[model samples]
Target: MAGILPKLIVFMAIFITLLTVIVDGESHSFSKTLPLRSKKLKREKMSHLHFYFHDIVSGRNPTAIKVAEAESTKTSPTEFGKMVIIDDPLTEKPEATSKLVGRAQGIYAMASQSELGLLMTLNYCFMEGKYNGSTLSILGRNTVMSEVREMPVVGGSGLVRFSRGYAHAKTQWFNHTTKDGVVEYNVYVIHY
Candidate 1:
């Protein structure tokens, strides 16, 4: 009788909880708090990474290419409406021949008709030691002509899971003739 009483109490509690959830129209919620997958990073940690991004659009083997564009994009002063898909290499140094650390794979669109503003959506996938297989996602506005542009680090995967931060990009070199450039990136991220 005592064992049956305990089981009945538990069953009644569960039923009441379910009834309340349905009555409040919260039964559709498919969300619940769960423990972290890995407890190795119990405390939040900050990471600073420096790298050079090579955007090669004009080379025979281009890393970035215009995948789509509006009819008026070619005539537009800012090349507005043009969309570029990039698999640009992230190198240790400004030179393209330098050691490869990862690749910036994503797309950017000319979101501004008046200015050279781009809507960047990319993932910085690291291949170097310690950060191998980790990726940090960036989604923000980038005014390329600015001396230094800041963008948000929205989220990430692998070692960078639950990461959020910002990145500073400064154009190190740009060639008008080739439409190629090297942008230095200093990224700071916080993760747990």
Candidate 2:
């Protein structure tokens, strides 16, 4: 009888603890939901996409051209803009030159003195392929010496409306003499 009494008491104590926790949780939820029920719902549809961008920007060979602006030399830092074209690597040949894809135009404002990065605002226009007539733009700073730079995508137009996300760019090949390099981009796009 003594052992049974102790077991019954212990079981009652555990049951009481569980009941208290459940009651407290229900009361708290009721109190919190009253204010939330009056609030308006803001929901958005988000879609994710990934693609690769290969660019060969050059100043000498003229893949990327400098505008007729003031003191826009490559060696010394200057506020300048350039127009660049990117062709699809898969169809890159003399006869398949019409299979162009990207046209990136942007300006390079000297962002910092410490690392030599540019305050870049680039409009990447897709001229050919499945994403033709769409434009994805990005605004961020990229250091000249950085092997990889991740930048935020601002917005987009055409099929990619209301786009926002991030992109990673790596300088694959660079020429110090001609001020040109091949940049590989892995872009992540989130849009509605």
Candidate 3:
């Protein structure tokens, strides 16, 4: 009976150690191995998408602008134009478009154009309720444009800098030309 008890203890210890190793191995593998692949994929996708958006924005397309504007208006109608909402305690009217532009310019001076573009893309994703991990395939009709703006937080103490802007479709049937050669459109701007 004494010998049998000792053997049982040894077996149990070995079993527990093996179990722990297996569990920890899986956890380590997932965190260390999978993230590398995931991050690489994300970077690759973002690079491809950046080029695509840049092309579309630089391209002279009127239809794309109309579609983007329509989509932005449909998604965020209340926040569409500059307006004073004195009655609403939750919202504060922005100071001015020029002020927002000034803030953006300051931030833009510090960052590279690619970084700014990435920031704008991220803002659009947040406003659109799209996951950042998801791929953005820009077709002729589904193009995006971004504008940078600085706005004071509605209730917070400090000002929040953001790329608040909109995107438009470049190949829609109803297209309008802005004073500049660029297509005129509205993009869902991010507050943060």
Candidate 4:
């Protein structure tokens, strides 16, 4: 009877702690703590964002090598070559044409050494139009191969919270002389 009583008490405690909640989009109140993935919340839908990044890498921009030599540290990240903050234009450049569009403001830094290729990280924001104020992050290897690179969208902000998806990047043009280039991205996201 003692063991049975303890089990019954535990069951009742759990039952009492359970709650019913109603979220009205704008505001929400939580009576009980629940996992963020609770099905009681609204169902998640997939979202997509596709845009082109026109990185016209001007010579005026400081290279990572210059930064490393300038900083001259005895320890860590001794070789920095390609860390850059992006302020590129996002275009809806189809196969046939390219159009003026929004802007992409973000940072890309070298996270690891290049054994096969350079592994970089992205924390980028989209400004203007439907995706205004949305930010996406990624950790990907940068290689100028003909094959498209797939980048995982780790997380996001604004309308892209709880974001998880993949972005396909294709280099359109890379100028060896001027050090300018155009890269196109097709991003797919699922967020709540």
RMSD each, Å? 6.0, 13.4, 17.7, 7.8
Judge candidate 1 against the unseen true structure and give its global Cα lDDT, from 0 to 1. 0.94
Q: For residues 1-192, what per-residue lDDT tens digits would candidate 2 score against the true structure? A: 999999999999999988997887756644654442254323434544343333344534354444444344344443333333333231222222434456666655555645567676877777666567888888997776777888888999876767898878776666677665556666777764
- In the range 31-132, model 4's lDDT, one tens digit per residue, is 555686674446777987777777765666422221222233223342334456666667777332466455655555444443224455666576667667
User: Deviation in angstroms for 71 in model 4?
Assistant: 11
lDDT of each: 0.94, 0.61, 0.25, 0.64
User: What does the lDDT read for residue 19 in candidate 4?
Assistant: 33
TM-score against native, each model:
0.84, 0.56, 0.19, 0.61
How far is 68's C-alpha from truth in model 3 (Å)? 33
Query: Clashing residue pairs in candidate 4, if any?
Result: none
**Candidate 3 clash figure, as a count:** 10
Ranking by TM-score: 1, 4, 2, 3
By lDDT, is 1 or 4 better? 1
* Prediction 4 global C-alpha lDDT: 0.64
Q: Output the better candidate (2/3) by lDDT.
A: 2
User: What is the lDDT, from 0 to 100, of the residue 74 in candidate 2?
Assistant: 49
Best by TM-score: 1
User: Per-residue alpha-carbon lDDT of model 1 for 20-69, expressed as tens digits?
Assistant: 88777654568654577545558889999999999999958999999999
Q: Candidate 2 clashing pairs?
A: none
